[model samples]
Target: MDQLPTVQPHSPIMAVLTEIEYESGMEPSFGSIHDFCLELQELFTSSGWFFYVFSLKGVTKDGITGLYRDGSRWTKSKMPFPDIVYNRIHSRRSESSQIFIDFVEKMNEASIPVFNRRFLNKWEVHQWLNSRKNLQRFLPESCVYSRNSLQRMAASHEVLFLKPVNGSRGRDIMRIQSQDSTCDVSLSSRNGIESLNTCQKEDLPAILKRYLKKQLYLLQQGLPLLKMDNRSVDFRILCNRSSKYDWRVTSTVARLSAQGHFAANLAAGGDTIHPLRVLRHFFGEAQSTSKLDMIRELALEAANCTADSSEELFGELGIDVGVDDNGHPWIIEVNSKPSKNDHIGKSSCRPSAKAILEYAQILLSETNPPEKGGSR
Candidate 1:
């Protein structure tokens, strides 16, 4: 395998793309997001940065490539170190993994700006969001779980989603809904409902046991989402912070979940539509117009809140916002590494991806004080 170019501590700005490999049994097959990652690499490359991607499976031409495997001897080229690193490590793979963690720590101590800084753990992000007042308006009730907390949350919400605390792109999510004395559990997927049935209240013990065996998950109250043709629809609001620290909305689109599915994730056979049209369909013309404006403002505010409170230097966020029947907007999830799906060919939203790339370039060029050092 070809070796990665060695980077100096004070080298010119370059973007490092690295992947965190999953455990042998626990990786999602590559999908649209993988393509988006490539587009980001191209964008970074075009902006005069040496863009490189490292994965456990060895390098490929798809992105500036590097690879790592256990017990494999390797060497890095003598070149200037990357100025910025895009940490795209998968979460399940990261748990109890030393190699990638060590690499990230070394980069941090060297003052290389990581897009989603390694120190900014997922729980910290959630905690930051929970503490903010402006963000509270958009967020659903969310809590990190202990066995007692999870049980209480389940009993209180009657309908909750159990999500891997660090998971992304809609994988390993289980929705638990209560119908009178029975509870229904369903796993999220791209094809269709993976499982659906009624479980007696007494089944909670076993279900919780199975869920807790994983050792990490978050319980969130399910948002009452507006539906299209009997399927839930939610909005993905893309926002990016400019080098100047101003937060801007890059794109907002509605994702209608596949029929019979509860999630509105695009990866799961969900189709995209203009948010305005969906707003109109759910709310009449007069109300829809006003609601769109409201949603846009809320999204920008949510993004800013996350950016300001968190220690990470986030250039972008993919915030999942759901609209209820009454046209109220609620933040369902906040994604630090928002997918660049808007860049897919010949789409009206493609420009958003270009804009994000440009913003990333600006961020790479400018220097901001580290969050711990001082105020921005």
Candidate 2:
């Protein structure tokens, strides 16, 4: 007999949709999905936005058939057109489908705004940022990985990274080091980090051919990243659009790689330390402030650059930046469909989540402004 809480001052309804394969109660809902919806609902309701969670399958042309709080339990209910949609379609396979594309297009035609539009391709983002002269210094030399490109980069930089153009969570990344007679290759796999050593540099093409036969890869010069406890570390800057549509750095977290691993992605057995903690640990308290400011500025620039390039509206980005031993910052990667994990920020506020709803409200107000009575 536990009643579902109701939203307050619910004038504008917001829908959060994700891919759900089966009906609820037929099977257990994904815990993460449920938690995400629950958390978002609480935040949205507190801010006077009516929020509900629905699956893609539940949407229709007339309106959306979604689950809403009905006394003690969630029950099927129909909702009018939503003012905005917060997409949480987590499956790559689902997003790739023609059906999903058509659905989004249809929603667009119906005038519903979707935030954090889609996943960004690494190469496309790099190419966009690389063309800007101001951003060029922060970008490492990167090009489509080909037999010749790999060899050329190997001849230039002592170490290079081969990354999938569409990869996430540091999956399938490889670290390649060109030695006098051999190329040292280390791959990040689900099982663990694996390395291929003592392979003649001349035979790299043949050896890599099988692995990259149909995959797209980017070869980037490896920066001498700052290390923590002898493990390579990088920063993940969570940026979100303000109510005014300006990009703001919500928070920055430092990810330290597992020993012997090059990737600092959380999925790759890495650990996260707050950037302030990292700064204090590396540079004394007296010097951490300036360095922190430098990182914030760099991250803001990257976020704005990405926003300028993307034609679709994106409200959030996770930008990975690395600081070399010399203290120069480099843009490593930019993720549009960023995972919202551990977003606790200054003053105990979940900045990323709060920013999302605030921006969504701004968008909705612009799109569907309330009528002013007895006004000029």
Name the candidate that leads on TM-score.
2
Q: lDDT value for candidate 2?
A: 0.76
Model 1 clash count equals: 8
For candidate 2, the TM-score is 0.88
Q: How far does residue 258 in candidate 1 sit from its true spot (Å)?
A: 1.8
All candidates' lDDT scores?
0.64, 0.76
Residue 314 CA error for candidate 2 (Å)?
0.6
lDDT of 1 by residue, 1-376 (tens): 3454533223334444545333455532234455554455456545544444455343222323342111222223222345566555545465236755665566577566667543234566667776877667667777776667766877788788877776666777788888788888888766676775567876765765664436577778887779989989888888777555787776788888889777787667778888888988878888887887787787777777778886667777777889987777987777865655543236533555466566655654565433322111
Residue-level error in angstroms, candidate 1, position 128: 1.8
Stretches > 4 Å off in candidate 1: 1-13, 19-80, 90-96, 118-123, 154-156, 189-191, 342-376
